[model samples]
Target: ATTSIAPTTAVATTSPVFVPVTEPPSATPPPTTDAAVAPAPATTIVAVDVPASTAPPIVVPASTAVPTTTLPPPPPAPVTQLGVVQDVAASGPLTVPVVDYGLPRVALGDSVMLGAAEELLARGFAVDAVKSRQMISFLPDMQIIRDGGSFGPVVVIHLGTNGPFSESTLNSMMALVVDVPIVVVLTGRGDREWIGRNNSKLRALPEFYPNVTVLDWEVVASQCPGRCFYEDGIHLTQSGQDFYASQISQLLGMG
Candidate 1:
């Protein structure tokens, strides 16, 4: 019992302790640089540069620089004279003569006279056809004989075919001429039947003028049956024209 009590009085020994680790702050990385703050890429940009000392020039065409030229006008036409003659006494009968004066070789009045003159020339008659406006107002006198030459005994007058003359004017014209037989070829009426009928009425002047002889153109027109006129219906066709000229030639004893 005494040995067991001594064994319980033995002393206890202490164990070693572990320490905690603490590291110094790591070195801070330098402030990070942004990629957007990098330099711009290289490229060339062209620009026009003008000087302040000079002004811009103006241009013009060659046609506007030259001048144009012009020419002058022409001359006017000439004037003339006209008349009639007659013979009231002869062994057979009385007769009249017509003498025309104006521009030589041209027919009197208008185209109808021209065609008549052409017909006369074809029939061996020495026709002095005058181109004249004065034929309408021509007075009968010896002055035309002095100017041109003497006309013979029988004078056949083919006139007023262009238009009708006033009664007083026609009478005055008749009064101007002396003693001669006057064969007044009546004007042909146009294609209208009414005109021909009217012409017969108007042709009563021979009763007043005793020395005048009236040749009926209506009768002449009737000879062709139905077609006596040119396309104009005023002028005569070749056949009509020839027949008319022949009738005149027979009346004047030129046939």
Candidate 2:
């Protein structure tokens, strides 16, 4: 059989048949992704130092000042002058000139004078004292101190123990002894109120008459107590007599 198969072979013709094939590419589109965010850092604290020279100084307030004051004291009381001289013009100026000579002491009184009679005589005093006789006023005794009687350069009056007094009568008695230099008054005493008043009047005589001196027998009565007076509180006792004499002597510039 000489039948020859037509040789089947790839024909390379001018217009060749072609088959199409598809495969995924290796460059895929970038995968879709979100951006990453970072966290912030923490804050730190720091301390500072200060010097003493850089600091402010402190101040103090002062106290207020004050003033001081001083005062003086008062004057002392009178001694020989017993009290204030109120009635200085009770009488005129001293008329009788004071004679610096031997002045005799003459005393005029009632019973109290009698007690001191012997002592007065012994002390050179001419005493006109009455025994059991009453001189209740300055009237009856005016005659005794007048004329050339008990009136002398120096005299003692111890009346008014039994009665009241008159200022005129006392002034008159002083007038009767106007020529006399010194007159010592023996203050009277009794249970009567007038007695003290009488004594006060006598004490005030120093202002009116320069020669007037108060014996202050009241002082003697107070000092010597029971020994200076009798039971009646009016008459002078024996000790009183001695005391009276000594006082008169001192007044007469003898003791």
Candidate 3:
């Protein structure tokens, strides 16, 4: 009975509505196995210089970031000058003696003595020097010097210009003239190691013998340096001869 009163209302059809859905970026997958992989750091190369650098070598780790610039190597140390002033300091200041005007003296040595022979004679010293005779001929030369030592109050030994000497020979040489007043000049090294050794021996003489006086010729040569020596280094130049004579004369109070 109610359907007859209804005013012809149409029945609605049942249908599902379709809608588009967007989910955010799918969670990005967390990089999976790639995240577990370890990477090695990059490396760089550098040049090395020898003489300019005194510092120790630098060490670098592989994984560290490469430096933009390396530290520059330090400049090398200057070479020490030979025949410095300190070379003669051990011998102390030379005693200026009261000169007797023409005091008697004698000298014995090698080629160095040969250069000084003229100066020695000029200074009124009774000089007996043989060329190229080293300290090894100590016995023979000491006898010659000993004979003249009786006539002169002072004796100068210049033998080590040729080479090295033994301690025993040096002792034997010293024993021959202990009673005599002696002045032993230290030998010039001239870049030779043995000459330095011989000079060291001569420097030690005063400690053992009270009558012995050590003349630091090494010190004298250092005063004028290159000008004091000849081209041969050990031999005296004309100026060197004069200087040596003057130093000896002054030491003995002859000056």
Candidate 4:
């Protein structure tokens, strides 16, 4: 018995061990060849909150617009009347009408006119003057000229130098040539007392006839003092005759 107990020993059996296997997930999807056959993307909708007091936005067109303008009114027309000359601009040549008086100037006087006769005749005057002749005795000559139809459109008379005539005699002389277009009467210049009285009558002629004009030779000759006349103070010197003729020519519209 003692020998069998010392040699008894049991043997154990070994079992196999099991471990779990795990692989990391792939970083990207696998490559595909049928890419065109994928489904289309769906519409996305986002929601936002808005206040009640906010206004809607305005849209503008691409084209631009033009502005308008205002104009002013024109001026008034020009005034027209007779004897009023208005300057007119002509596009072409213009014709002007000429007036024909149909008569020359006829002048009758005493020695003072005789002194200026040469100067006056050269200025287109028909002059007839007499020395030491009175106005009272000159009616027959005026009648002869009027009857002979030789009296012109303009008549000039310078008398009352040799002697004074009555106003009745002056009226008789004026009656012959009163129908003439123009009649110019002259006052005599001298120291004679009758000269003043005769000039007063001569100045009165314009009151009765509208075509009469008085040329006061007395006032004109007095401007030169002692230089205008000779020692007699009735006849004119050379300067005085020139002045006298110039005055007559201006009155007749010749100067």
Candidate 5:
């Protein structure tokens, strides 16, 4: 038995070992990681100062300038010569008024004359007046009177209150009583534009004809300082009528 145990050989046994189960690292990173990004640059603001002396001035144009107003000239001044006869005075030392009331007298006019009809009749004048009478329409009546030989030595005419009369018409009217002494009454101040123009023609009559005379009633009526006229300014008040009658009377040497 000893010989058999000695002849048996001894056998060797090995055990298995394990390395860590790690895989190779990837080329791209995982979604769990977030990368930080850089921000853009901001703009900066700065302030500047300006000088007052270098500023531009405001201008206004001459074409757009405000216009000035022009008013009309005033009426002509009143004539001073009332009833003077220079030729007659030059001829002799005797001086007489332009009218004679001793002879038959006629009064012709418009509504203004009608206002003083009774007063004129009292003063020995045949009153012939029509309301709103124009000089053109009244010329025919004057012609009728001239043809009939009823035109008296003295004539008092007050017209042009209703409307305008031409220089030719005035001349023709005066021709009707060429030889007779006539008294032309200047119209009072009124709203009518023709009043001043008519009075101007009336005032110049004596220059051309010796038989003509102006009563200058405009001057006379102005003395009352707005009391002489009724609201019409062309017609007379009671006091105005008295003054009117008295002026005519004085002119005729009756007052």
Candidate 6:
């Protein structure tokens, strides 16, 4: 019985077997497995496009300019005839009559007398001239006019060149000729001593008589040109005759 039981046990009875199961070290499971993803990269935003605006241009007004003009000067005024006559009167009146008494051959008084005669004829007046050898020789003639009292307003006595006369004689003659203007023309051509003496006598006459007039021959000579006199330096030429006539006519206002 013992043998039979041992065989059966070896054959059918399995000994107590230990199965070893490895559970992957109790499933720690890769520490619950959360994946470590990289954090997302930061994003930057920028403005892409912008618009520009335009402005209008400014305008200015123009200025107005003015033009300048120039004017011409006026013409001079004309001289009147009355004014010319007044000027002539201011120098000496042309209304007075003239009587010339001078020697012709000795002192060229004939040429002067002829010129004066023509001038008086043009001025509507009668003229006469007497030529004496000397002024003293004409005393009788002057005395005749004085006695008759027919002499005019003016008597031109041109003398005292050939010879010298005393101041007393000249004064006496002047005194004898009364009631008229006596213009004593001093001698032009003569020595300086005679001229000085005649001038002295003339100056004395103004003190004695107011009616006595003294005309300067030197002044008349200054107005004469070279053609007015002859080459002899004493007498007047034809041109001188015409010039004297013109001067006398102008003084008388004949033209």
Best by TM-score: 4
lDDT of 6 by residue, 1-255 (tens): 455544334465667889997765754545644888688998888877766546666667687677767777875432211111212324553343344542211111333454455544554434445443355766776677557545555444555654567876787777764455433333444343575676567545655665554444445555666587666444557676665555444443445
**Reference-based TM-score of each model:** 0.45, 0.55, 0.57, 0.60, 0.59, 0.48
lDDT string for model 4 (1-255, tens) is: 466556757665667578988988899987887668767888888887776766786788877767666666665332111111111111111121122543477889999999999998988888889998898888898798788776756778899998889979999998987877667788888899999999888877878876676777777566553476789888989888887887766655465
lDDT by residue (tens digit), candidate 1, 13-128: 76657798997876996577865666687888889797676666666656664666665665432111011112211112222233353221111223455566778777644444
Consecutive 10-residue window with the lowest summed lDDT within model 1: 79-88
Give candidate 6's error at residue 185 in angstroms. 3.4
Name model 4 segments beyond 4 Å from true: 1-103, 224-226
Highest lDDT model number:
4
Q: What would the C-alpha RMSD of candidate 1 be, to one decimal place?
A: 23.6
Clashes of 1: 5
Model 1 TM: 0.45
Residue 252 of model 3, lDDT score: 58
Residue 14 of model 3 has an lDDT of: 75
* lDDT scores of the candidates, listed in order: 0.48, 0.65, 0.64, 0.73, 0.70, 0.50
What's the true lDDT of residue 122 in model 3?
89
Clashes of each: 5, 0, 2, 0, 0, 0
- Which tens-of-lDDT digit does each residue in 1-255 have in candidate 2? 697888788877698769887767769876757766465766666776755595567666677667666556665332222232222233112222345443456777777888889998987788777764434454556564565354656777777676666888788677766656666677776677778988888888888876676676665556553478777777778888887676655644566
Residue 206, model 3, lDDT: 70
lDDT of 2: 0.65
In candidate 3, what are the lDDT values of residues 9-51, reduced to their tens digit? 8776977688999878866686567556667877777876657
TM-score quality measure for candidate 5:
0.59
